[model samples]
Structures are given as C-alpha cells and as structure tokens.
Target chain A: MDYVLELQDVSKTYGHGRTAVKANDRVNLQIQPGEIVLIMGPSGSGKTTLLSMAGLLLSTSSGIICVLGEQIDHASASHRAHMRLKTLGFVFQSYNLMESLTAIENVELVMNMAGVRGSRAKERARELLAMLGLGERLDHKPADLSGGEKQRVAIARALANDPPLILADEPTGNLDSKTGQEVMELLCCGLGRDQGRSIVIVTHDHRLRSIADRVLWLEDGQLSETDGNYLPEMT
Target chain B: MFKLAWRNLLHERARLIISVGGVALAVMLILLMAGIFAGSEEHAVAYIKRQPADLWLMQDGVENLHMSSSLLPPQVVEDVRGIAGVYQAVGLLYSTGAVDLGETEVYSYIFAVEKGAPFGGPWDLMEGAGSPGIDEVILDSDLAARYGLGLGDTVDLLGKQLRIAGLSEGTFGIATSITFVNKQTLAGLMGVPPDAASYVLIRPESDADRVQVADRLKEAIPEANLMTREAFVASDQEMIRQMGADVIRAMNSVAYVVGLLVIALTVYTATVERAREYGVLKAIGADTALLMRVVAAQAFISSGFGFLVGIPLAYGIGALITTLLPEMLIVIEPDNLLGQVPVLLAITAAASLLPLGRIIRLDPMTVFKG
Candidate 1:
C-alpha cells in the first residue's frame, strides 16, 4: 500500500550526556489511505514522541518525514504549520477544545482561520457537528458538554479541513470506558470511512486496539506488530 | 481570520469586560481634566470678551492688564476719543474686593464700565441683577447659590452697603464672581474718591482697523498702553495657561501612564492565559501577523467599548460637575472631547503591542506536550 504518511530513521533526544534520554531512536512508521493504525505503549515508551514527530509538532533530531510524498523535514516553520493545518488534522489527548467556544463555533474556528468566512463556513461547521451526532449540542460550550460530547466535538474539529491524514495522541485517554469505546469507534471510523484519508491513533487503551485495523506495540522505543486481540481486556 | 479575533474577544468575555472598564476609567480621568482646562480657558477670556471696547488703553509698557499696567489717567479716554476712527471711549477702574453676605465674606472682582457703555455682561442671569447703578451690585449665579443671596438683598462691598440688582450667569472668574457697577459706584466702593478712572476703553468704528486705532491711541496718549481686542484676549488667556498648563500636562501624562499600564497588564494577562489557545491557533496556520492582528483586534474591542461608555460617562460626569461647580470651573466642549478619541486609540494600540509579542512567541508544539 502506498503510504499517506512515512517516517524514516526518525530520532528525538532530550538534554545531553548522562541525563540525556533518547525519546525515539531511528523510529520508522508508515500509514496508508483508508487505514486505522494504533500505537500502544506505556507513558515513556515513545508513542507520543513518535506521534509528535509524525504530526510535525516537533522537529526530529535527525531523519526524514514525508507526508503525501512531500518531504516536510526540511520545510520552513510556517510551511510545516500550514501543512499540518491544511493536510493534517490532530486530535489531542486532552481534546484541547477551546473551552470558551461552543461546539459548532470550535469547529468553525478552524474553518474561519483557514480563510473560510461568513455563513457558508458556519453551515459547514453545523454539518460536521451533525455528522458526529452532536447536532443538538451545536451551541453548547465545552464547559457545558459531557466528556463524550467534547471528544466528538474535538473529532469534528480535527475533521475541519477534510485533511488526508489524522494524527491523534490518546484521543480517548480522558474518557470513561463506555465513552472511550464510543470515542474510539467514532475516531476509527471518523476519517477511514473516506477512501482518501487515514487515521493514526497513539493510545494505550486496549479497547481502542480492537477498533484499529492494525496495532503496533512500542516497547522501549521499538515498534512491532501484535495480534489486535492479545492485549488484556480493559476494565 | 480577523473575524476569529473578534470571536475570541467575545469568547473571552471576562477579559473583555475588565479591559473595557480600565480603558473607560482612564478615559474618564483624561476627559475630566480636559474639561477643567477648557473651563479655565473660557474663564480667562470672559472679561476680555465683555470689555465693551474694541481697543484697550492702559498705561504704556503694559503687556497684560491683570499684572503689568499702571492706572492711566481718565483724561486718556478723551485723547483716545480724539483719535481717528475712534467711535466711543469710557474710562473704568478694574480691581478686586471682598463682599460680605451676612456671616460669609466672598472675594470678588470689580469691573467698572461706564453706565450704558457698549460693553455688556454674561449669557444668563442667576442672582439679583443687571447694569447696576451707584451703590448697586450684581452677583454671579454661583456666588448667589453659594451665599444664598437674592435680588432684594443688600451686601457690603469693600465696606459700602450696596443693594443687589440682578444676577448674571456663566461669568464667574476662577475663584470669584465678578460684579459690574458704574465707575462712580466702583470708585466709591474702592475709596478712590471717585476721581480719574484706572484705564480707558475705546470703541473703534466697525470697519476701522483696530490695530491702527490702537497705535494712534498709543501715539495720541504716550502715557497709556494700547492693545487690540485679540491681543487683550490672548494676554488674559496666557495668564491662566501659564498658571495651569504644567499641572494639566502632568495630569494628562499620569493619565496616559495609567492607561498604558492598565492595557499592558490586561492584554498581557489575556495572552498568558490563552497561551495554549495561541498554540492551537498557530498549529492551525495562523500566521505571526495574523496573531498580532488578533491581539490588536482585542485591544480595539476593548477601546471601542471604552469609547462607547467613556464618552457618555464623561458627559454625564461633566454635567454633574457643571451643576456642582461654578460655570467657570468646568467647560465640556464637544470638540475637545471628540478630539481625544484618536489619542486614546493610540495609547490602547501602543500598550497592546507588548502582549502581541508574547502571543507571537507561542509555538504549536507547546500544546502537544501537554
């Protein structure tokens, strides 16, 4: 399968000498269209580190990252952010919804910042919220919504630009088991339902493992594929 | 994108409210001080405007009537009248005295124009009267309100008892209300033995050159000082300007400092509070200039709200002050108030720049770390 996002020999090191920790060492990954890939690891197993590098949120100490066959490792800061905003959608662990904005407004915020103005952008935001089953919560602010609703709103925001690649770091980490499962299912099917896009969710929740098409286990900065059902059942 | 800036301002409603209040307070202080300065200016020129003559003839070498002139002989009025284009001339004594209203004594200025001279008085009347005769006096509205005097009341002026005739409005000097009386009444009140008046006022023909009339009067009576109407008004205005300009300037500077500090702290707090949101915005392709504009837009929102509330509050407060104060204590000129809008905007923009710097430094990767 042709990879929609590819990372080659990616490495990120923090500090130096004895105190230095290698967050990711020569990490390599590939994500293809219409696929949902899950990266599961403990807190320090470099799952988020690798995800950040793939998402272009952080600069790698060394190596190349290619998105849609375009090398972004050497891209300018503004160019990289533009690529992220236009071609990549991110779902943060905390949901990262602007608490002040209503659900629909949060979605519209991304569209508006991307130069979408007036009533059309607003209508598009409403459509996305309805697609996420948040039609009734459109005008509800983040503070007034439930955990599941907020996560769905975050998913709607990530889908704002209809980007080809979605990068999520523990997207359901803050939800309870039921909401987490619903969020995982929503996220897994959120973009992959479209033929031209893919999702890469970095999470430790075993429940999410069943929803992802393939699971990649990261232990001590190394990735290896595991049977999707081998993880211990979530409580 | 800039529309997002406006939405963000509304989103962060608390910050908007607080910042608007700060700007309004600063605006109020600045406007009030401006009103006082304007009032002082009007007061300084009041008597000059009512001088009854187009030409002022004082002792030679006089630069200001209030400070520099010696008493010119009453005969100087005849000499000035003899000058070509001089229409009418009247000699008058201008001095300061104390008036006794029962247990309270008030200091007042005495302007003694000849009875039935071309010069008249204020815009309105508030107390006992107009065109006072010998042993008669007029009290300013504020003075009447202050001492509880009425039209039929008798007051002691510089020791002589004079019956109150009519009250005038909008003609109060800095600390005193002026009394207008005929030359004989004022001279008698001052114990000048009703002799030659202190200075002469000359009215030139309507189309005549006032400066030329002034020069001819100077030549005709070398012992008297001659000044055009404009010079006379300017000289009087300069005294108040000199007395109060520095203080007003310093107050204005303090107001600006307070405004700057308030806006800076408020915007800076807003920026720091939303550091993560800024990260999200940057991650979403918001450029540096876009972020700067967003910050500036927030400042504009705050200032715009301030403009709406501050101007009317300024007028309301100014009105209250105008009511409580003598007319000369506050002048709320619309033009002066309107002129301050741009200056306030400049302060708000400049103060918000520092917070914009903080916002521009936000990195999209910062939020991912959390």
Candidate 2:
C-alpha cells in the first residue's frame, strides 16, 4: 500500500495479426504517495497510452494494474469508474471544465460523483478553488476564465474529492510560460505534495523537471529514467 | 448529474424554449383533439346523461337512443310506472330530419315528449317555456338565433309547420342539434295512434332498490329492453364516438409522433453538442447509469414542463372556442389529464434512448485527443 499506483509489465496493442501495432510494450512503473513523477516523452512514444492505463481510463491488453491496493485491471467498467472517483483524479491539458458549469461547480462535480454532495461538497470545492486563487472566479464558466484560471479550476477539480493520486495530462499546455509555471507550482508544490497526494504528469515540457521529484522519459513505447545528461526540448 | 443535464438545457435558452414549446404544442394538439371528441360525445348523449332516469325502457334489442329505432307501445310506460319502486315514467318519440328554418335547413334530432311531463328529457329552456304545447316545438336557442327565428316563430318539422314554443340550452352543436315537439304531432305525422311511444324513461322511488325495480319492470314488459341510466348513457356515448373517435385517435397518434420527434431531436442535438463534456464526465468516473440518468433527466424535464404547460393552454383554447363558437364545447376531464400522464412519460423515456446509446458507446479516451 506504500505505492498508490503500480503497473507491472503492462502492454497494449491495437489491432491483431497482419496489422498489429504495439502502443505499450510491457511497460512497468510505480508511483508512490506524495511523489511527483514527471513523464516526458516524444510524440507517439505511447506516453498517453501508458498514462491512460495507469489512470484506469483504458484497459491494458496484458498487465497487472493496481490503484490504492485494489487490482483494477480486470474490474468492470463501473467498478473502475468507482475506483477512479474514490482513489484517483485527473487534470486534462485543455482545462476540460464543463462549459455549462461554473468554476466552483466544475470543482464540485468530482465530489458529487463520489456521492459527497450538498453543502459539504460545496464548501470543500470552495476551499479548493480559493486555495488555487479562483475565489473571485467561482461563478465564471470555462468561457469566461483565462487559460491559467481554467487550469487552476481543473487542478481544484482534480483535488476536490481529496483522492490520493492525481493524473495530469499536459496540465499547463494551454497557458503562457509564466502562467504555466505558476499553475505547475501551485499543483505539484503547493496543494498536491503538501496534502500527501501523489502527482503523475505526462507532458512535453522539459522546464517542468525542476519541481518533479523524478523525471522519467518515454521513447518508442518504453520507459527510462532521464539523468542530468538528458537534453532539454521545446514544449 | 441531473443538475448538469438541467444546466446544459438552460445554457441554450432559445433551444430550450423551442424544445419545450414544440412538446407543449404537440401535447395541446392531442389533448384538444381528445377533448373535442369527448365534448361531442357528451353533447350527443346530453339528453340521456342530463336526465334523472333510473331506468330506460326501449323496444326489445334497442340498446341506445342515438341512431337507434325503439318502438315501445305507450302501455309499457304505464306498466313501468305501476311497478313497485317506480316513481314516474315518461314516453318519447324520436326521429331524425332537417328543420326547415325558411332561410336554411339545419340537421337535428327531433324528439316528441308529452306536453305536461315533468321528467322527460333535457327540457331546460334558455328563453321560453320548458315544454312544447300542441303544434309547438322547442328548438335550441343558438339554432333559432342563427336563422333569425325565435319564440312563436314557425319551423317546418316533417312537413308539418309548428311554432317554436321555447328555446332550449346546450342542445346545439356542429351536429346533433335537438328539437323537441309534442308527442301528438309526431304521432299524427307518423300515422300512428297518439298512445304509441318509441321509448319510455322511468324514475325509481327514492327508497327503492333500482335493480329490483328494473328486474320487475323487465319481467312485466318482456317486449321492451330495460337499462339503468349508466348503461343507457354509455351506449349513447359509444354510438356517438363511433362517428369520430377514429379520426381523433389518428390525430392523437400524429401529435405523439410530433412530440417524440421534438424531444428526440432536441436531446440528440444537445448530446452531440456536449459530446466532449460527456467524454470528460465518462473519463472522470461517470458510469453508463449516470450518463443515462442525465439524458433521461433532460427528456423528462422537457416533456414534464411541456405537459404542465399544455393543460392550461388547452383550457384557455377551450374557453376561447366557447366564446367564439358557443355551440362547440371542449371537455377536458380530470380523467383525460390523468390518462395522458403515462403516455407523456412513455414518450419522454423513448425519446431518451437514442442519446443514451450515443453516450454509452462513447469512448472516454476520445476526450484525450485534443
């Protein structure tokens, strides 16, 4: 139970026989609680495929995936969703807050899905958004918020249910440099790590390595640790 | 979330209005068509439904008064009155023909009641006497007004000229206008003895058991069919509905189809518009049941609001019709409203299926694309 997420030799392949392409070839990774693991990879390196498998958003062709001591590789879709709601949270790159919902409501949605509703959920969502500097923008929809504000709302939503693990896919890809750095700092250093939550970030941003506890690189559907010798790339 | 579905509908205010409006109009159409049929049936059986008859005695095998010929001898009325528990019995002669109003001939049902009978038919008058005198007839006030005819004005009934002795109320419609005349005139016209009668209506004594009295009357007059008031009213309504209920049913089916299309199209388009949001929800721990709930909630919101709005609109239109066309009545009974609730719910449920399937099959991974 020390590791919040564990993936053992996970493999995913699209199609079969004559026209098979392996997206992840027996990838193995483990993320411990309160750890910031940054996944940097080239496009089509199957980084997203690996992240999706870890997040329980996609099924692995062959592997043992466990989240919070529960083996969910073969769980029913509903069960996996339940696991995701209770044990994991996600932050998308585009800040995919529902257009119809306000900033506070976007954050409250995950908690509501976990059956934490009414005023308790509302107060938690409010505290999360306020911590992320979205107190004044609580009533603003996705359309009204700036990119950085939207990403903060996404982070607030990701932490709304107080899940132990957070999976962020290019959380700052839509923001400018200063704004992106602030969002990353607020997500990984401010609220996430301080609250004993593990964070997994999949991105092409090399500058994000400074805050990460471990920076790993994905290439050709395989994972490898990037030492100081790794070259920096433009996001 | 249901709140999410509701907000999604509310976000597009114009589409929401159009969607709910479409459903409301369809519901109104169906209810109005049904109300019209019910109103017509009520009008056709006005005499039977309005009268306080405990039992009806007609010629053997004549089950209804509308479009039925029942020739009971006048002695049957006296025989029914003589039965224990029988308070009073009145006889009537019925015929169907057009009334010659000099300028225009209006199709009507002509009934001949006894001149001094207190318990005969819907003998209520709006402006004139309650019963017709010798060589006199009682016509609907609306019909008399339409032709510039009034009390003491003459109308030709079966080629016999008779004065309009009284003008009756609620006896006119698009069809089935009633004209009441004295039994002596009708008997003389049909070349039958004045004592002959077509049907007999009986009122049971206040403290008597109607079933026992009806049995005794039936035994005494085997040549006549005996029916309680409820059976008689139902039979008349059945005959009246046969004339137009099929058209009403067909119209109602079309309206329901319109409602289905409106709800389905709006929900389908709304789902497609929010496909990415739905994908986000799916990726973030929303199960198929939750997605289905959102879709179903949207459909029910549209249909439930539409139905709630339709009832008042139907009543408003009914009032407008009553004012503009006094002879036409629109009867939207509580039973009618209660009956349509299941139909609307079923339509809403059916409307949700397409969008539900669309979202259930959506891959949450698609939200990762951009």
The positional error of residue B30 in candidate 2, measured at the CA in angstroms, is: 2.8
Q: Candidate 2 at A7: error in angstroms?
A: 3.1
Candidate-wise lDDT, in order: 0.77, 0.86
Candidate 2 ranges with C-alpha deviation above 4 Å: A16-19, A232-235, B77-88, B100-106, B119-122, B127-137, B147-166, B188-191, B203-220, B238-247
| Native-referenced Cα lDDT, model 1 | 0.77
Question: Can you list each candidate's DockQ?
Answer: 0.46, 0.67
lDDT of 2 by residue, B230-298 (tens): 998988887777877788889999999999999999989988888888888888899988988988898
Query: Best lDDT goes to which candidate?
Result: 2
lDDT of 1 at A85: 77
The numbered model that scores best in TM-score is 2
The weakest ten consecutive residues by lDDT in model 1 chain A span: A187-196
- Model 1 regions more than 4 Å off: A1-3, A231-235, B1-3, B11-15, B59-63, B96-108, B115-138, B148-167, B181-199, B205-231, B361-370
Q: Could you give the interface RMSD of each candidate, to one decimal?
A: 2.0, 0.9
Provide the DockQ value for model 2.
0.67
